[model samples]
Target chain A: MTTSSTLRPGVGDRSVTDPGPPAPRPRGDGAAALAFLTPSIITFLVFVLAPTVGVLVLSFYNWNLLSDGTFVGLDNFDRLIHDGRLLGVYGSTTYMALAILAVNVVLGLLLAVLLETRMPRWLRGFFRLSYLFPFVVSASAVALIWRFLLNKDLGLVNYLLGLVHVDRIDWLGSSAFAPVSVIIVNSWKTIGFSILVYIAGLQSIPDQLREAAIVDGAGAWTRFWRITFPLLSPTIFFLVVINTINSFQIFAEPRVLTQGGPGDSSRTIVEYLYDRAFGDFDLGYASAIGITFALILVVLTAIQFWFSRRWTFY
Target chain B: MSTATTSMSPRLGRLAARVLTFLVLGIAALAITAPFLWIFRGALSGSDAELYRLPPTFDAGTLTVRNFGRVTEQVPYFRFFLNSIIVSTVVTAAQLITCSTAAYAFARLRFRGKGVLFALVIGSLMIPIQVTIVPLFLVMSKLGLTNTLWALILPGIFSAFGIFLLRQHFLGLPRGLEEAAKIDGAGQFRTFARIILPLSGPSIATLGILCFTYWWNDLLLPLVMISDTDRQTLPVGLVLLAGRFSTGSLGTIAAGITMAIVPVLVVFLAAQRYIVQSIASSGLKL
Candidate 1:
């Protein structure tokens, strides 16, 4: 789309109307593009590209800042495989991520459908704004807010539970409950984004399709499932890809709340990786975990992409 | 014409559906905003331990600014606040200048290696900061940038997402713009500066806002890079405040959280309508 315009900026009739060869392009276009691209390319190389290579290489060799440790090929990878805690970490992380994704997709779709129905426009706008308001707040703040609210002794949640003569569930203090608490916290933090995206996706669907379905003696449920849901698949597919990747990188919520505590019940891979690198000062092992986690995300995203072909409708 | 004879059942059903919408959305909205409400409540509840008592009472007399005062007095709240502002602003500005230039090249210019370079740029998206943090940490320490704002700003100035976002918008721009500029004897640089940049204001603004928020809300990187408490960003600072108050009532930490989020809250409230709409439209593009 853009190259054609760049090639024939002023006129496009050179091949059709002119018998002579097309005019030679200006020598400055490539030069300008190079110069324009230089700053970002340099930054990308130094910060992004270089570190990517650094992690891959670092994973293969045991090295610290002060002493250059000897090379140990595949040892880091082997260690990651043998580390029994990894299975638990992966399980909890997947469970948490799937819970988060389910909340985002299902609740997000529900919000979109609700807003699509009869409602005051202002009310819809206000809720949308309020929902996204928490998103702008820093992750640490969200963590802190939830920490306060879920305080088993004095938190508003437990306090309200006490009002109804119900025992307060351990929101963060217990192993079994911490993962669920962070899921709720993290879900609250991120669900607005998907809801907004779904709203946008909902708007893109044509009204006539739903109208035709209804005219053909379809109930509301049938119309939605057969007509609207299939049409919203592209958006769903996009969110699934984006959110799954994001959910895998869950760090701050668990880091700040459970600290992978109550015996690593809420431990995410990123958090475990963080502890290995920073807490243990085990750079090589951390790099290995990093590479492994990155590969998991890449593979999962690729698989999602492959599956999307069957379900995603343009 | 027969629509005026609609049965009461359908109207009642519609009413039930509308009421259900309100019921469901209202409950969801309540659950969503519950944290913010609790934060506000905790921020207001000071030494009055009743706020911490089971079946807490939120009396007007219990509200106090003592915890806010404590937060400011205990930690260098102002320094952290200023550091966040400066770091996020510089990152945002540098990104706007850098990401757009690169995006323009990928969108409008055709070089021999454009496709490969663009793919590499997209490839960077798969490499999250976690994967790069250890090496970046060492690199920063080597360069003596570890406790400075430069460590935060410089590494963040390059973003694959920013480039991707702007490139998509630039590709959709009308071809007549650059053609008109070229017909008037404008060179590539002149056309890009005068016509293309002006026309891509909304895309630039969206990217700028996103980058700023991303930088501002950053915790993990700052936690790794900035060890000196004096140089820490607000997120790090909040965590530190929490650690210090881990033993006592959470009032002071709540106050610190409130302080940290206030600026972001203002920014959000100011541009919320525009941000939400732009986010939606950008979704369609992606």
Candidate 2:
């Protein structure tokens, strides 16, 4: 894959072994490169870079979407410190995110491991694709389907539960149940992705190691706990980081299923941010929340990366 | 006799574990696929009451396609579907063009501040949409593009992830073809368009499908940007439908969801390998 020779200036004309930085032919390739780069650079600046900076600046102002914003330094931050609802939102968001992460990683690993065992080819393929089916569907659509299926009185879930003499549980209405319901629905839609990733990670592990462990008379639990787990730590680390970032951003499930109802029990950060910016038109406060959440995520991701060195194998 | 018993017990235990694993996996797969079948079944039920019936009837004779018609008649389902198609298609195309070109520049050509510029591009990936949606909303409002499809399309057109993925693919390509093309008097753009892109179909398809699935299924952007019924995407439309009609028209709501997900499910099944590989690979490395 080395391209150092091709990158050397005038090397193709002279010889093939020269190594240097790329100098795309002297005939205005820089201009051509600029031409190639301009579209992405412009869009990235306008939509990503500038707006990122703008959100931070807007956090210091009082803009209600209709009028000019007056600079009101520290007021938004002051309010953010005291906002009781914000505290609950963060709590529930973290709770649900962690729950979803646990279900995804653990169940995903279990399913992937089981699938790795000897099975009929069609059955294996069926299980693999079945788990992934929900991942392809949109979150909102999945939520809508689950909303009907999880309804306390008439939904099929309760009906099935009733068949076993279990009482109906208010899945979407009760504050106690809303967050759990959200975790269930969200996990249902997402755990498949984790399973697929784990399967791929399992495939990458050499079979000889597992066979050698079997020859050593190590049982299934022993083999997994000792050999497979450590080898898959890097993959686990990757899924943890990814799932943490995505889970904290949960929006559509709670939005569609509960509408962040029953006293903000299931409200996620993004949904709350949406409510402030669009629903209440409290753009400044929303921007402050956004900035704070972003900062927290940055710190959290850094902490995870820092911790990974101690845990991740590679 | 004791030695035989010890080895036989271990073998029996292993066999039992294998059987349990097979049963557990079978049940889990059934549970996973059940909801999809449930949605499909609900969509076809002839009567709304049938959805609520205890030990729900599985009779095929009781099902019909009328609920699908009812879904469309009740709302602008087709309009939202059309909007989704247009927005996702345009965004995917825009990403392929913008990202691949930029990736080619990063991977093949030399430029000033290339390292810093590329770092900035990668840095954008860490910034979530929630952090920037406020100002983006204002920008859309200022430009009079609020409640329009362009509001969704514009922000989605450039993906830092797409650029990163494409650049990785481009960097792996052998330099012989490009150098020979250059020696034959082909321009950089000509060589890229003629030689590089054709060889990079899998990476391009991977990016395209990823982008399409994302924009097609995205909720928050459409939720914030498009309010007009005529402009809403399918996810937003499905949410609105559920909010308004979910109380009585369970079948109709299911019909709408089925319509929303079926095409994606079909495409996923057809390209399951690519979709799965893309997510797994992207997860591992990115």
* Pairs of residues clashing in candidate 1: none
Assess every candidate by TM-score: 0.92, 0.91
Judged by DockQ cut-offs, the docking class of candidate 1 is: acceptable
The second chain of candidate 1 has a TM-score of: 0.93
- A-chain TM-score in candidate 2? 0.90
* TM-score of candidate 1 to 2 decimals: 0.92
Overall lDDT per candidate, in order of appearance: 0.82, 0.85
lDDT of 2 by residue, A230-270 (tens): 99998898899888988998888999899998899999999
TM-score of chain A of 1: 0.89
Poorest lDDT segment (10 consecutive residues) of candidate 1 chain A: A1-10
Which runs of model 2 end up more than 4 angstroms from their true locations? A1-29, B1-8
Residue B228 C-alpha lDDT in model 2: 83
lDDT, candidate 2, at A133: 80
